[model samples]
Target chain A: MNLAFRDIRHNLGRFVLTCFGLSLLLGVVLSMIGIYRGLVEDALTLARSPQADIWVVESDSRGPFAESSRIPGDTREAIARLYGVSAAGAITYQSVETKYGAKKLRLYVVGYELDRLGGPDKIVAGRSIVRSHYEMVADRRSDLSLGDRVPLGRNMFTVVGLTENRVASSGDPVVYLSLRDSQELQFELAPPAARREMARDEGVPGINTVNTVIARVSPNVEPDLVAKAARQWKHLAAMTQMEQEIILTRSVVERARKQIGLFTAILLTVSTVIIALIIYTMTMDKLREIATLKLIGAPDHTIIGLIIQQALAMGTIGFAFGALFISSVKDYFPRRVILQPDDGLALAVAVLLVCILASALGVRLALKVDPGEALKG
Target chain B: MSLNGSHTLVEARGISKYFGEGDARVDALREVSLKVYPGQVVGLLGPSGSGKTTLLNVFGCIVEPNTGWMSLDGEVVYDEGWLRSDLRRLRLEKIGFIFQFHNLLPFLNCVDNVAIVLSLAGFSTTQAKQRSVELLEYLEVEHRKDAFPAQLSGGEAQRVAIARALANRPRIILADEPTAALDSARAGIVMDLLRKVAIDQNAAILAVTHDEKIYDRFDRIFHLRDGYLDIEQERGVTEMTQD
Candidate 1:
């Protein structure tokens, strides 16, 4: 019989309890990893979803996600006429909070020309936005069903379609609107603010500002070359789609990544310490048995195997428990928890290594036990 | 003891052991010497500080004697220091130990407790199990083979302990106080079992004990006092002279 398993079998209740406790800890670690991945994925979604080859924004700006970058809405026309430009559209982005039913909801609003490159990549339900004004495509996370009319910026817009996994870097669900409506919503001041501005004789600029002018390059043309051409305009900062994604990750969500990574490291350290203490305690509990084992001439490897095997079993079972628990309830979390296969595999490997390292304490204690102790009492 | 010297299973000569140093030093064993032959159940009788257990540890390959000549199954295993690199393997092959408390692994059932020894000796699981069952059956505890250590009575646990000791068919069995925890009747039964095991397996049995109730069961008894062997008590019991 495998002695380690026999010992576990002998004390199954305690073993299971220990594993359950460990699983919850591991679950938190896994969730942090998932949340971190989700944060980056969310930050990159809008940049990637538009499927543009190049981005033309305000001069010297990393926007539209990392910072504010408002160019004239007419920049789309200039970008479209540029050499090698296949398609171009000006899009505006803003975060809005509004009352829906009795609940307050936050949303990320994106405005794009109907025939342009920027739009929700997929409509999982209902139809795409058909009207230039008063029609919207909302992410399912917003709980806006088809035909739901949500008031926004002095106008009511009907939800004509629904999307999934489309959210802002801050995790607010994204909603799509026609460029005309979005400009009105994003740049339009409240009636009182507008009146005050008019009374002060400061003429209200027309609501014609867009966060970014996204362009698709011709298949045979290099997007970088097109971006370089746009940058020569000096008043406009342009970047290829890859560069935009880099900015989003590095500027928009970098701190969150570092924070999550630090928390994960801390949790893993705590887990290692907890596992070490637990193994040490378990070894201490069985010191006599270990002594007897030694007295009976069991090999050092056998003793080491017993401790390491127990640690590994605990870690494996705990990881499975944590993974399953997190997977079953991830949707309930406000932030997306994306548990990818690769992440799980990596975590499993990490847990395996951690278990081995943690078991060192127990193995050391066990190896140090004097066989003569068994002959004592 | 001068048994047939050719059949001596375990022999220790001038085995001197000390603990600590200087003012705090203790002579746990002083020039102790003895020999046990196959099929003999030998008992070392002594008081609490008489060093019986220490001597047993030395013979069991647990403690390295500061100075000694030791042999098991006619092979020199320790001379002043361990002659073998792996004392554990040497012990596993030729020396079996039975603790006073029947230190069978609490987690393993009686059969596994016994079979683990054979397994450590490199027997296949099936072979180990088969041998363990035969040993348990021989000791009349086959019915309790699946019972864990806690479930066994003192006598039953000791019987299982004996079975484990015989698992690898070691040439020598060193039991420390095999019957100290047993009642007189139960102690007699355990002693009978040990004697039976010794004769049946042709293994030498050296046991340390303070219990005199089962004293008659041993084929030869040696008394120890103040780390010195009572050669007077051993003289009438064996033909070999203590050096």
Candidate 2:
């Protein structure tokens, strides 16, 4: 064992170079897994923040991304009156492309009742929205800071606060505004179309409606009862917090989840094959030495152990490099690459296993080598 | 003659080894028998294709013969079947081998390479290392202990190989053309070291070589031809016939 370690130390340059190559591949695998985890985390962050017990939307729809769900603006008022409903608020959601400097940025605009119940839980910078309209709390990733003005539709809103990681299902950074703003952004028609519709409808202004009503239930009251009462109403669907998150994840981001899963699987397969080939080649290169060891009474187990130890060393070094490399450069990527501790740990274990399995090919070759070959001409 | 009650370190009876089968079969050794007693140097001399290596392999317990009764260190080790399943342990504990080419692991320093056999035999790392250093000092290569095998000269490497072979303190040392790669001077030095190790350690040494120039140094010489062995007494020694 001492000899084996000393041998590796003597050839440290080649060993480290091989480890670096392995680490790059391992880093890609780790990044893929992290990206998938990031997507899931980003989807749930907004939903979890509201602290709402139940969500009310249109019948037979998954919100707030997969399908349209518009409820009467007065639905919150009605739900507030219901038994066991402690608080209810109208919320609207929409994705829009807007200009920031010379670049176009995609934003998930979340409309909430500023004072009622829905808003960013904590502001990291500046102050929370003080005005009712044309003010927003932007997630830090949106590149918006306090006092910065961003154009939305025909109006421009000043960013009042900066939050972190508040992204929508599609992983776009979120911007929070009063419910009226989000509703207008989603439902407000063009001025010409609005005039044409009003002219056709005898010039009466339309009432406001919203995509969904989120409610908090009292601890003493059963949540299912409130949800049942809301579902009894026409054009309404009520779900508990758990159900809403599931609906969004299973319906809105189902395709992305599957795509990420497929990518992870393919990357893992490629990594395994590449590691196996590298170990096999290394073993083949040392065939003569291995034969001599065998001839000199070195046991098969010793030979196998040498190969396995080398494989494990390669994997450990590669994983360390990959982890460091990805985290150091993750911020520069367009999409969020979340490198978490658990993800790193899992990848380390996986890479180690891959290396062990990979070196089996080398072990087989070493085992089949005839000791007699050492004596041959 | 039976070596049942003698000081023989290795004894073989009617050893036969064949390769392949049917018409393609080649008999590498046929009905070969030899005895090597402790504290003596025995040389097996033969030309190419004369079964010298085949006999060495059988004596080294690396290849099982088709028919043989072999004993090592006064204990039966083979009788048409291997008596020990752990050939590696047998090789490490009972016999030492020095090859023509100094097959030291390239990545290891001279001392570590010498200590490898002891380490494989379950010695502590520190103990094996210390023993290797002691042996190198004995062989007069201690100054080059930290040098890798590649950095050592031919004579130093060969001397290191002898030290490695003696690491386990085996009762028998087998040298298969150990000096084949060296010049006359280096070969003489290696042979002298082998003889000193045999006498100082009280171990039997069996060396097979084509070099006849060093024959007088061996205590006994066996001439092998077509897998048959003939004992040749030295000119000054009296030949003892079977009673």
- TM-score to native of every candidate shown: 0.96, 0.92
List residue ranges in candidate 1 displaced over 4 A.
B4-6, B231-243
DockQ of 1: 0.82
- Tens digit of lDDT per residue, candidate 1, span A1-377? 67889899989999999999999999999999999999999999889998999989999898888889989878889989999999898999999998888988899999988977899889999988888889999999998999998989789999999999999999999999999999999888888888999999997769989999999988899998999989988789999999999988988899999999999999999999999999999999999999988888899999999999999999999999999999999999998999999999999999999999999989999999998888766
lDDT of 1 by residue, B1-243 (tens): 556554678888999999999999999999988777788888898888888888888888888899979888999988878888988888888888887888989999888999999889989999999999999999899999999999999999999999999888888999898998899999999888888888888888999988989888877888889899874344343554355
Worst 10 residues of 2 chain A by lDDT: A1-10
| Fraction of native contacts (fnat) of each candidate | 0.88, 0.41
The deviation in Å at residue A109 for candidate 2 is: 1.0
Clashes of each: 0, 1
lDDT of 2 at A131: 86
Clashing pairs in 1: none
TM-score, cand. 1 vs. native = 0.96
Taking the tens digit of each residue's C-alpha lDDT, what string does model 2 give over A1-377?
A: 54446657988898888888888888888888878877887778888888898889888877655688888899899999889999988888888999988889899988888787778887889888778899999999988888899999889999989998888878789999888887777778888988898889867345488888889999888888999999888788888888888877887777898999899889889999999998998788778778778867788888998899888888888889989998898877766788889878877888889999999899999999976566554
